[model samples]
Structure formats: C-alpha cells, structure tokens
Target: MFVLSSPSGTGKTTIARRLLAEDADIALSVSVTTRPMRPGEVEGRDYFFTDRAKFEAMVEAGEFLEWAEVFGNLYGTPKSYIKAGLKEGRDFLFDVDWQGTQQLHQRMETDVVRVFLLPPSIAELDRRLRGRGTDSAEVIAGRMARAQAEISHWDSYDYVAINDDMEQCFTRVKTILAAERLRRARQTGLVDFTRELMR
Candidate 1:
C-alpha cells in the first residue's frame, strides 16, 4: 500500500493519476463511500458507492481496513480487496487525507509507504484553489484553513515532496516508489534466489 496525501489544491490527485498511467505495477485502491457519485465516475472504478446505512453496516461487520468520516461523508478501504491483491504481489495506490493515511499506517505498517505532498506556499495553494473556480469563496476559505492543519502532519509521513514544480515533484515521488520496491523486506523471492546461487 502506497499513500499520497495532501491538501485539496496541492496536486496529489494529479500526480497519482500520472503515476498510475505510467506504472503498470500499481493500481488505485477504490474506496467505498457514502458520498454521492459525481459525473464521470464509475461505480467500482472510482468508488463503491453505497447508502449511509449500508456503509454503517459494513463498519459494524469490520469490513474496512481503515475508515473515516470526512466532510460529512463516510469512506473506507475494504480489507478483502487489498489482502488478495497484496498476496498476489500487486501494489496499491491510495489517495487519502491525513486521517486515512494514519489509519492505514496503523493497520498495515510493514506494507504501507506514506508520502505527503506539500504546496510551494500557502499563497500558491490558495491561488491554485481559486484558479479551479468550482468552489465558492466561503468554501475556498475553509480549505485554506484546513490546508494549514494538514501540513502540520507532514513529519508523520515516510517521504515528503514539495510541489514547487509539477514535473520535478512527480519525479521525486516516482523515485521514492522505486526505492521502496527495492527494500529487502519486500523482496519475497530474494531468499530462494540467494539460496539457489549459493548451491
């Protein structure tokens, strides 16, 4: 499990999309959400949309690896989906906030690689949010306030990339992924290969 987390306007989603497009080994983890699906989102591809009751029921049954309530909506990662993928030696990418990242790390510390993206500056983040023009002034203000709070948790992540330049930031993130993949503990076949070489 690889996690990319940042404030709303910090380009985490943009970088995640590019990484998924370029890397064949990693697939995005589609979360289950109680939020209504927006346009252009597929049911299983983007999220597993469900009603509040069903989502609560899932929680009661302990179906989630990590779950949280964000902006009045419930979101969770299904353990069954990720467990099967991990056993097959597949990588999963997670695009979540600090809360979700913390939960994921607690539940799967050995398998989780946490990366936090930072904006060049608060001013730049505000400009980026305003540039989108999809939110009202009030909402933008709220996001800016939340961004400050989120950035405070930067030290908790395994890696931190500052998004001063999009291409450079993406490159840094890719480098981190590559290094993590080469970690000795993650090399499941290394012992067998080394034994064979000695023989």
Candidate 2:
C-alpha cells in the first residue's frame, strides 16, 4: 500500500488521480464516508456513502482497515478484498490525511509506504485554497488553521514531495512508486526465479 498525504490545498488528490490513470499496476483505495455525496461523485468509485448509524456500526464491527473523523465526517478504508488483491501482487494507492496514514501504518507497517506533500509556502497554500473558489471563506480559514498541525507529522513519512511544480512533484511520486515496487521484500516471487536459475 502506498499513501499520499498533504494539507487541503497542496494538490495531493490531483496527483493521486493522475497517478492512478497513468499506472496500470496501482489502484486507488476507495474509502467509505459518512459525508454527503457531492454532485459528480459515483458510489463505490469516489466513496461508499453511508448514514452515520451505519458508519458507526462498521466501526463497532471492526470492518475498517483504518478510520478517522475529519471535520466532523467519518471516513474509513474498508477491509474489503484488499488481502486477496495484495496476495495477487496488486498495489493500492491511498490518498489520506495524516491521521489516516498513522492508523494505516500502525496496522500494516511492513506493507505500507508513506509519502507527504508540502506546499511551497503558506502564502501559496492560501492562494491555492482561495483560487479554487469552491469553499466558503470560513471553511478555508478552518482548513488553514489545521494545515500546520497536519504538516507537523511530515517527518513520519518515508518520502516528501514539495508541490512547487505539479509536473515535478508527479514525476517524483511516480519515481518513488517505481523504486518501491523493486524492493527486495516486495518482490517475493524473485526467490523462486533465482532458485530456478540456479537449477
């Protein structure tokens, strides 16, 4: 599993979307949430929307690989079919917050690769949020207030991509993913290949 985390305006989601489109080997881990579905979002593809009661029941049943409450909404990675996919050599990409990343790493330390994205500057972050024109000023201020705390965990991630330039950052993340796939532990089938060659 690979994770990309960043403050709200840092463009991590965009990077993850492009990465998923370009890479055939990796699939995004769609999360389940209690938040209302937005206009363009499709069920299961974007998020598995559920009522608060059902979301809470899932937590009680321990159905989540990782879960967290963010800005009053509960979001979780369901432990659905991921184990079988992993055994078949599939990669999963997670676009999550730092809290979610922490929970995931705690549960799957060896299987996890964590990456954090940094906005170039506070001013730039503010600019990006304002430029989106999607959120109200109050909401933007709330996100800005929380950004610093979220970014404080940067040291915990294995890699950090500075979002100074979109293309450069995407290249760096893709390169990281490539290198991670080649790691000795992840290439378990290589043992059999090597032994066969020796025979």
Q: What's the CA RMSD for each of the models? A: 1.8, 2.3
Tell me the tens digit of each residue's lDDT in model 1 across 87-139: 99999999988888898988898999999999998789989878668889998
TM-score of 2: 0.89
lDDT of 2 by residue, 27-50 (tens): 999889999999999998889999
Backbone clash count for every predicted candidate, in the order shown: 0, 0
Deviating ranges (above 4 Å) for candidate 1: 132-138
Q: Look at candidate 1 and tell me the lDDT of residue 67.
A: 93
Q: Total backbone clashes of model 2?
A: 0
Give the Å error, residue 110, model 2.
Answer: 0.8
Question: Which parts of model 2 are misplaced by more than 4 Å?
Answer: 38-40, 132-141
Taken over the whole model, the C-alpha lDDT of each candidate is 0.93, 0.91
TM-score of each predicted structure versus truth: 0.92, 0.89
